[model samples]
Target: MFFSAESGQINHANGTQYFRGLEVKEFSEETATGMMDSLLYAPCDYVITQSYTCMSREEAKKAIKRTRRLLMSADDDAVSQRLDLDVALDLLTSGKIAYGKHHFSIMVYSPSLESLVADTNEISNALNNIGITPVPAEISLSAAYMAQLPGNYNLRPRKGELSSQNFVELAALHNFYPGKRDKAPGGCDGFTAHPVRRWLLYQPA
Candidate 1:
């Protein structure tokens, strides 16, 4: 796998590639060559290369289930709510939840709409305490969205699949070129070309 800092893309010869703790798609030979040419003409601060083992679909599903189980077990009324809030704060401070580069959305799954409505203020305050004052419009909790949450957790590389060097290089790059807190969604910020699955556990905030 070859990651280009200039493009923020993870390119691979074939199959899938893992970079920065995420799984990105493979690039065609022609496209990969063109990317290389572009990088040569406009050099970037760093280029990362690595070898990794990807997780199969069953393995990925099992991992997601395990994560969900852990989150559910940890969530126990106010105690778990406070813990989740603290985790979000810690992630923000550690640069894991950068504004535009990587942002977290709270997804609440309740048995009924009334339950969600009742917990709205509690959720809002938790985010507010961490300096992330989201507008009412940004919060959404529905059976439809909740049903799809498990799918969103799929396709991530298994833990320890990536090398230590990959983490080091990614941390260095983020330090030098930390993404802005923009919400427009375009360019490399979206990372649409080489989509990668994120590892954040999506539990109610």
Candidate 2:
């Protein structure tokens, strides 16, 4: 994919385009509820893409082995390594955490190129305030955009390992503020659009 000066967007040979993509690299050590904090008031159009794939039992074993090997190679702190292993063990045994891999990217779109930049900065700042780190997709912009497509996990955009519990926490699944419908009685048109978000899980291929 390449940036088009004329269109002010990343352009594919086939004509798909996007203004910009920011990836969720790491979250702050401390996070609060509502991952999409200020997004509700976004003045420009945007998308929050999230894909999650549940790991098979064999995949979990391999992941644990790979993590242990990495820790050994890096000579990480013993306590840190133990903590990692403990979480893995807890996933395998206690089953409190559902093992999975996920991809989370936010794409902002606007007719004005300058607006795209400003909106991106605003979104990033808002998320940073809530302890989320979103960085430019850079070379992975194409892959990230594609990964957001429904049933497009087969392309295998880069993902980070996480547990269901952790995903729910990062996703702020507990954030629920119901609003009145647009045409409800008594002038209760508080929300413009209220969408029901559902988590679509895919069994590992």
Candidate 3:
């Protein structure tokens, strides 16, 4: 839930040595809706979504809509700092993509991805839509989510080495691969600057 360097000023608090972003005091549709509204005015430089599971298209649509509302109205400071990002990959509503709820996960800086998938033509028409790109959940999930998991657990040589296999498989469920130490061009295994650049671009001016 927290990325130190990626979190900017929020990584450390004046009063506390460590700070986690956004403690949820409440959870509900109204709260979610309210949060979504806030993010639009305070859009992130980049909004990344990582999933260890697949989301229905309908769910993806709903997620994109929520993201759009947030990115569009996010405040300049928050946007500049890339705050208030909705990063969970879970499907918000129920049902199937074709007949039920719409669900989408994205790594972008868009007001919404629904248009990209449902209304590509309209997306082309909109100005300043760079943040609106809709990549498959797998790409971002592989790159962002899996790559960010803390591998820094307490190590015990006598207890045997920590297995990255579980981590790798879990990430793969959502189409992600474990961040590999080896550097390969366009490799999905490790954290890279590409995601950061995406975030910075949408950062408020």
Candidate maximizing lDDT: 2
> What tens digits encode model 3's per-residue C-alpha lDDT throughout 1-205?
2333312112234331211111111112111112222223322333322223344555555655565566668743445322322322222333311212112222232223342233323322221232223223321233343333355122101111111222232123231233444454544433343322222112111
lDDT of 2: 0.67
TM-score of each: 0.22, 0.70, 0.18
Model 1 misplacement above 4 A: 1-100, 137-205
* TM match of model 3 to true structure: 0.18
lDDT of 1 by residue, 82-187 (tens): 4544554455456453211111233332333355444444454443443334343221222112223455432222123222223333223221223444453443
Model 2, TM vs. native: 0.70
Error of 3 at 53 (Å): 1.3
At residue 124, what lDDT does model 2 achieve? 84
Instruction: For each candidate in turn, give its C-alpha RMSD to the true structure in angstroms.
Output: 24.1, 8.7, 19.6
lDDT of 2 by residue, 60-151 (tens): 76787788878878887776755767677666766666678887888787656777888788778877877778888777777766777777
Looking at model 1, how many pairs of residues clash?
0
Task: Give the best candidate by TM-score.
Answer: 2
**Could you tell which candidate, 1 or 3, scores higher by TM-score?**
1
CA RMSD (A), model 1: 24.1
